[model samples]
Target: MITKSIKGIGKAVGVMLLIIFGVQHVEAQQFFSYSQYMNNLTPLNSAYSLIDKNGTLNALLRKQWTGIEGSPSTFIFNGNLPIESINGAAGLIVMNDQFAVEHLTEINGFFAKGIQLGNNQFLGVSLNAGIRRYVANYSSLDAVDPQFRNDVRENKPNIGFGILYYSDHYYVGVSLPELSIRDLGNASTQRADFFRNHFNFAGAYLFGKEGDDVRAKPAVLATYTKGVPFIADMSTTLYFKSILGIGVNYRTNNEMSGIISISSDIIKLGYSYQFGTSATNLGGRLSNATHEVTLSYRFGQNTMSRSIL
Candidate 1:
């Protein structure tokens, strides 16, 4: 009887694993971006749109788990413009994330209103609306299980809001991407279930005088979901002559990274490399390397000539 019970438990565990893997495999592709912590600047909070001094454009590309087959890759493009006359800003973001054999494409528009505070501090409130397309390919799983035959496509609409407070030397923000909504798709067969809420907080501090040619900037970002421990990212950047930048970052339970950035009067370029740690080391060197790049351009008039916080 004990042997039979053990066999039953093993079968149950196997079935559970199959279900979890199948569901996660599809959902994983929808949000497969390593630099999500940075991308959250827009999707997580509307107030972040007002953080920039001038009209700016930015792009990001990420590749994770280098040697692993069908690991994850992502690309994003976004632009923001501050309407100084009304203390408001407008922006748009587009992203494509791929993991395993699944993919997610999203486009969102954002708006933010900035309110002046005492002593040069400011607060901003932001809102965002967007659509996400989720696609999955189950052909790869056919060899493992012939019963897995549901390869489908889905699209969903979502809205998010955020608040931010900042000054020349420091900044902090909070945001929720999905609010409390659930089941955003209209398909008869449920393709995916998005989290009801994703909470984020970030802050940055600057060291050194404003006119100094070099300065140290330290920043931290934290994220949380229901029933999960908080994940934090700590990073620091050394800026030289207001144009060149070098930085390093560490993500809890994940990886360590090095970064380089350049900003001019018209454009900015950034690149980052992440090396996996802990259990990730078992995946081989190539599998540990993750890469990211960002590009930004300015438009319209140049009112504020510096970038900080």
Candidate 2:
């Protein structure tokens, strides 16, 4: 009798986990998202590798749903530089994410070449190639279901492409962050294929004079997945003498965030605090809040001293 009761509980847990996985896999972006995309753009759009004329190194750490167990956490690092000789730019991006029973890692290399459109205006196209590693740890479950007793790991290849148009004060970009799909392996004979085909568009505009005491910058980022509704994010930031900044972000009923940042000639530090406002109870129950931090360093000369916030 005890054996039968334990088996029933295990099955119940397995079913619950399956439902959660299905919902997340289908409704959300497969890749980890950072609120500070403006600070570190390479992870989202390869074409952004050349945003700065000089080489740039950036790192971001994000903790999502602070009070929730098995919540997602991400670490990303990227560096990019312009090759004036070739009229191109190149970058390297590495990201790792952990959530629930799954962990993912990706390493990508980006190359882009641009042509001068006019004074301070340019157009560029970029390509990214990478390998993705995914692993599921079912052994960690307290009561392992018989159907999910087997552990799974997959290593796959992915490629992406992007285009960007930018001038001294404004920029626009479009990209496909992932181009390949992988089977997540079955849990209890249920097909759980990984979602694929994500499209992203981002743009920003800067408002100020050559020596303005303050400036206002507005930016927007939108994403589309194959089967999910579109996700849009908009933000506006105010900068004081290009040194300190404050901003707010709105995510279409999903979240609202407050941003604060400080910058100098070579280093930048930023932080964002997000509040959940989704109509769904899951957003309120599972997610307490989201926090993200970004740090970046610029090498070589400081040709342009503007904040991308």
- Which candidate ranks first by TM-score, i.e. highest? 2
lDDT of 2 at 269: 96
Per-residue CA lDDT of candidate 2, range 200-229, in tens? Answer: 899998898656779888989888776566
Off by over 4 Å in 2: 1-26, 142-144, 181-195, 279-283, 303-309
Per-model CA lDDT versus the true structure: 0.68, 0.76
Candidate 1 lDDT by residue in tens digits, 1-309: 677656645544544443444343323222333443442366456687786768877778887656555666788887888888888999887878775656778788888898999887999888888887777665444423444456757777878888889877878988775553456543325333333356778887878877689989888878776544456788898989878888888877456788888877777788888875655342233355778887777776663466655
After superposition on all C-alphas, the RMSD of every candidate to the true structure, in Å, is: 7.2, 3.8
Point out where model 1 deviates above 4 Å: 1-40, 140-145, 184-196, 280-286
- Model 1, poorest ten-residue lDDT window? 24-33
